[model samples]
Target: MVAVALAGGLFTAASGCAAEPPSPRERLIQDLKTEPQFKDYSDKQVECLADAYIKYAKPEAIELIMQGKTPADSGWKDGVDGRTLTRDLAACNGPIAPSPTG
Candidate 1:
């Protein structure tokens, strides 16, 4: 019985550690909803920001944005003005990345 209980605990711990992290899209929404600065953004605004970040920012920049850091001056390029992108995202102005075919 002791060995069985110990094995069960080990399995639980291992599974807990192995739990998958949230995908970028999920993380972006979570950040927008949970971060004090971004909490007031509408759902559409949050979606835009998430889409823009997923399409533009590098991993480090994404982490920073998730932490409530502004993207301006972060040196993360999106092929659009940083401030404009942020404003557009806040306004839900279609942050979808442009197609490469253009």
Candidate 2:
């Protein structure tokens, strides 16, 4: 039984280590530098930012995101959408890879 428990713990640790952590907006910006296609912009990005805004920010804040503005500099008055935006951002974690530059 102890061996089985140890194996399980090891497996859990391995899985956790193998999984890559999600990127932050700042990281995304850096990625955009190399993969400029990501910089091209998209309606989906706006929609995601809007969803994120609605969760962590106000309607106007969400509007800013929908307009392609980053939520970090939108002058939010009510504070963060917190866990809500965090969850939405997770859900919005689809591919944002830029297309070929040339």
Candidate 3:
């Protein structure tokens, strides 16, 4: 099981070329599929965490979290309770195909 992080933001340079990155929900799932710690988690767990993160966290904070930081450590706690997501993730079993939304 792992912690959840969520988000979305806009950024602009002096030239006014602004860009919006993928949703926090998107990033978390990407991490779960790619990042070392999360890659091995079941799709159910990733999906569960993604939903929780979108409901509770800031997207930008996910980078630090992927680096092994917790929602509390990165101070991204908001929306749903972190404990609930953690418990849900722990219950999910995976590494299977036919992913949640892949």
Question: 4-102, model 3: which lDDT tens digit per residue?
Answer: 222212222334665779776777788778866676676777787777656556765666676776655545555556687666555555443575878
The local distance difference test score of each candidate is: 0.72, 0.55, 0.63
Clashing residue pairs in candidate 3 (N, C-alpha, C atoms within 3 angstroms): 6-57, 6-58, 6-59, 7-58, 7-59, 42-94
TM-score result, candidate 2: 0.29
Displacement of the residue 27 alpha carbon in candidate 3, Å:
2.7
Global local distance difference test of model 1: 0.72
Candidate 2 lDDT at 12 equals 91
Q: For each candidate, give its TM-score against the true structure.
A: 0.49, 0.29, 0.44
Q: Which residue runs of candidate 3 sit more than 4 Å off their true CA positions?
A: 1-22, 63-73, 78-82, 93-102
lDDT of 2 at 32: 38
- Candidate 1 local lDDT, 1-102, one digit each (tens): 999999999999988896688898988787778867666666876787788777666777787766767656754664657786677555564434565876
Which residue runs does candidate 2 get wrong by more than 4 Å? 1-41, 59-81, 96-102
Q: How far is candidate 2 from the true structure (C-alpha RMSD, Å)?
A: 13.3
